[model samples]
Target chain A: MKHFVDTLHISGIREFSEMYINKEDCIFLTIGEPDFNTPTEIKDALKLALDENHTHYPPICGNHELRQRIAKLESMSFFESYTENNVIITNGATEALILAMGVLLGHGDNVMIPTPCFPLYQTQALLTGAEVSNYDTSTHGFQLRYHEFSKHIKENTKVIVLASPNNPTGIVYDEESMITLHRLMEEHPDLYVIIDEVYRSMIYEGEYPSIRDYESTIDRVILVQSFSKTFAMTGWRVGYAVAQESLIKQMNAFHQNLVTGVATFIQEAAITALDVDTQFMLDEYDHRRKYLLKRLALMDVDYIRPEGAFYIFIDIRKYGMDSYTFCKQLADELGVVIIPGIFFGTEGFARISYGANMDSLENGLDRLDQFIREFCL
Target chain B: MKHFVDTLHISGIREFSEMYINKEDCIFLTIGEPDFNTPTEIKDALKLALDENHTHYPPICGNHELRQRIAKLESMSFFESYTENNVIITNGATEALILAMGVLLGHGDNVMIPTPCFPLYQTQALLTGAEVSNYDTSTHGFQLRYHEFSKHIKENTKVIVLASPNNPTGIVYDEESMITLHRLMEEHPDLYVIIDEVYRSMIYEGEYPSIRDYESTIDRVILVQSFSKTFAMTGWRVGYAVAQESLIKQMNAFHQNLVTGVATFIQEAAITALDVDTQFMLDEYDHRRKYLLKRLALMDVDYIRPEGAFYIFIDIRKYGMDSYTFCKQLADELGVVIIPGIFFGTEGFARISYGANMDSLENGLDRLDQFIREFCL
Candidate 1:
């Protein structure tokens, strides 16, 4: 067995979720997916594809039309000209992230990631025998500060991972941070950046800042996005990577053996998905987010006001308990489930997803308030 | 960039297929999937799952019902008791193979593979930083002879990859070879074998011989099966690996980051897929296999008689051209496409798939006959 396999533990998020998954009457705020079902139009498209017998192996990169649509949409969003050649549809953003890491990092290489980051970044970087250097953003309102970020970049650092509308903390990096990142990339010509924008479409306020804004640095940027969050198609396992043709070519070479592309009919559905308006779901999430924030404010519990995605990072350090203990006790005593921040490379904070239904959110928040009052205040 | 990424090339099979895919009037015998659409029952089940909104992340291992059903079916087939704990549903057999390799092989480890084999076995082993040791089965009827296999085993050899009803050759390993494999496992306590039974349900001859027949060796064997060919669901991207609980645990840990799991609704479809009898597709494949064999015999081309799967490895060495040249010329001159065997780690041979519709296969065979006469003869 490989040493890496031994080092690989199930993600703490999953471990905690599974522990309470079967518990009766438990309200789960641990989901990272949209609670909504896939849009009907997308489902109808998939059904049509099945009827048409699109059940053979798809082209390894992806269906060309889906790639073209993705490329066109991304080009418009990023203000860059990207063609079908610049994209490769993947199993999900997870596979896309791993593919990017696999192509760019190897043994003894260093991948600089922001903490509290998605755990997959660390695990995937480690799987490639690359060393992980974490720059903690918890102290700076969950945003990257240039001086602090630069300190973590060693001579061997080959890549930097940034997730806008980040998990655990829903703070999307502002344009200033993106500009600083572009400056850093300019300063370090050898550096590459993997920007995970899986939640790009879920933003509630303002324009999403992308590193692609600086076209000069576009060559080294690997943009990973998914239909999972925006279209509520997580189960469909459709996501894509957009990068320079050279990088896309390398990722495609590796992707050929990684799953031989996503399901063909699903790709067709994804084309329909790109056309479907996600505003309805985003509006619902915004409603829930506002409701939760109001309730939490009334309870006087501190949390980051999430601008995007469906999560709120609640500060539990004041409760004098570690995130794990706080979450475990919350689930056990109140039957409300939330993920520990330790799972996402931070401590003393836990993540509350608002992706659950309003009823669950209202009840879970009430239970959380009760637990906090009884245990802390 | 990782050196391995530099070393990786798109498989020659795909390269050839893509070149001819858009060409007008081309008769392609290059597919490895069943030409039939997925069974109606399975598709309907998927549609129901979608309607019912099973569009969230499934358990990282897989859906419990699907795993339970797979365990039951495999347990009966292998004559060994397997629980859902022993299985991990993957994106496809491609992901399963990579997961197995990622878990078992690391830098400097050796993986012994039989050739001419599926190109993925080698690429995946390389991706793990493991050296691939090929035991060319081409010399001995595409079946591993114990004496020849023994020479490839080194002290650092961690795994042996065997694909029965193999790609290109379409030859199933005999009971004698499996027994010999069991003996080898006994002699080498550290050795593990990965048996790919993706083509198991397509066998035309006697009972599929499995290493699991020797219950004692079951702990050391990892069985990979897929719904792609068997259910004509290649586009669905569903497969599973069955191994001991400990191995499955480690693989699941890796799989969580690989792609989470296959689509939730797709897994539901897979449960229904298991009960849909594949005898109809198998019968069609058998019919095509016999027709192809008879046609090739009439053409006096020396080719292996396929016992399973949908491919026939033809001996084109007599033509005094490399497999690439032979295939390229055949496609160029007659609009018939076949894959070069060198892509599967052997030269001077080409693979002709019978998975094409009868009209295409018949026309392709006619063109093939013309090519042989005009070029080879």
Candidate 2:
């Protein structure tokens, strides 16, 4: 008689955005998917792998060369203490996150997640029967303040889920904030931290900071990242987790029962992805990021400048409308698609992704500006 | 501090089988990996798909055409109640199995698993904190008897996990047994039945019996299958689950959080998989199956004749060794590898796979004969 599904409600992002897929004239800014084509080099490597019959199951952990490639990348990006044992390829960062949940949280355990984070964190925790401890970061520009952890760390809290550059708000944690959080976690050695950095490659300003930079050991930090955002390989669903070897080994156990590993040629393609030039996509995102920032500045609304990722989180509180209603009216009337911030667990704001061409962004933003001109008055 | 990893022990299929990957003289009948080259058509289709850049994140359920193809296959093979809504593509039958567990079993709930069987079923159940009620089918010639279910059913028994053309034992369920199991389920409407049919395509004799033959509705039957064993596409990690619309929807929720569905171009390739001529591989497996059966007939060992899958579960009890010890000693002394039946939860029998070519099978069987002559004496 006990069912977990009733505790879960699918987020509003898809419910509202799916209606616009067939509207050719609609300037959509809804989902986080990028518009860049997968790199020619990566695709070429995949084609070669297909021709060479690399379509067999790689080891459940991953193809050795791919894991090795990820290890080398992790060494430069994360910790030197890590090796191949510390990395395991997953379906994507999505599976990577699920594995983290599997290893860290148990029934009736607590998982602390910042509000307006990816909905999946809460979904997975609930699926595993873990209670989600959501801390609203709306007041702090969506960055976790040290007090946020202090106020919410319960005796049952097992893991802290952090995303940076954060979804919706695109606020990357500063070095000071990262160090302070580490200090708090160091005091509670029992707590685990998983930082999702899918948007690390899309940073428009400053070096992407990682918890690995402040922690002396790889013991507590579990870094989940993907080739989707960086390599325009979202559909490929190739991602990984870098943690202490034991934690990774445990995650691989769950992953082994789940997908075994990502597809063989897909991992092979991802190996070649390491060498592909990602500057074109990053440069384009930067161009669009700046344009959207200027649009935000001129709109006379409260909005945080996106430090990284493609989304701009803007407050719609002045309109006195719920986030879903605001987004619904915006899409239906103005022919623009944007995600309700309530979908990410906050209201009175919505996230607009600028991961599209300049023409669409201009069109969508102009529509937004017109809507604001009429509605704000 | 709490971990599910402790409940999961890696299966010996890998630990012993891996020792031979670099040994040229080694005759391995270990893992169920097929030795046949992947059919050219699936690879060709995949190649074309990659060139066209079919790589993108598929829907959480799957691509429309891929689901349609699977639904069409199910319509003829399963109930007419099946449509795209009844089918959900997974990472493989492995992920499909895991998703079934996620949607069906909750913590402290009971799941019935027949042994010797694939170890992943027990692994996934425990990962979700579900208690596994394993029923040893070794006494029944590795077939699930009506008594097996009657004995194992408990107050919390929520699911009965079945595999047709059983792994390790290779005994397909006869129609009468399938109907009997269905009748038992009909008695307990709350009990779910999941039959893994990954090896359905590899049967050497008799029509593969499905629950669909007796049941007009798909409500209680969840069919998990993969393209790996059948199409010689083990490495692609593509598979599907067919159930009623509601169960598929719940499974899709987990599938969405797990890997967001299989790869895009991979699913596109799968759309072509339905049309790939499968008779070639079927004839090859039949040829190999007859050869192994003949060899088993000449041997002085007790073995269950495999009806479908690539394995022959031979009794090694005469050697007076536990399954793991028997396998280890065989690999060390005879230069052969056979999976320890204990890995599948039954002792005194070892599973030898004929999924390889004629040469490897002959060599491995000869080594086994030599080992038996020396040890059985």
Q: Highest TM-score: give the candidate number.
A: 1
Native-contact recovery for every candidate?
0.80, 0.58
Interface root-mean-square deviation (Å) of every model: 1.5, 2.5
lDDT of 1 by residue, B185-261 (tens): 88889889999999988889876788888877789899899999899999899999999999999999888767877
- Residue-by-residue lDDT tens digits, candidate 1, A1-377: 26677789888787889898789999999888898888899999999998898888898899999999988988886668899999999988999998999889988799999988888899888887888999888888888778787787888899999899888788899887898789889999999999999988888887777888888888999999999999999888889999999889999998887788899999999999999998999899999989988998999999988999999999888999998899999999999999988889899999999889999998898899999989887
Q: Candidate 2: where is the Cα deviation over 4 Å?
A: A22-24, A77-79, B1-3, B19-24, B147-149
Clashing pairs in 1: none
Give model 2's DockQ, 2 decimals. 0.58
Q: iRMS for model 2?
A: 2.5
CAPRI-style docking class of model 2 based on DockQ: medium
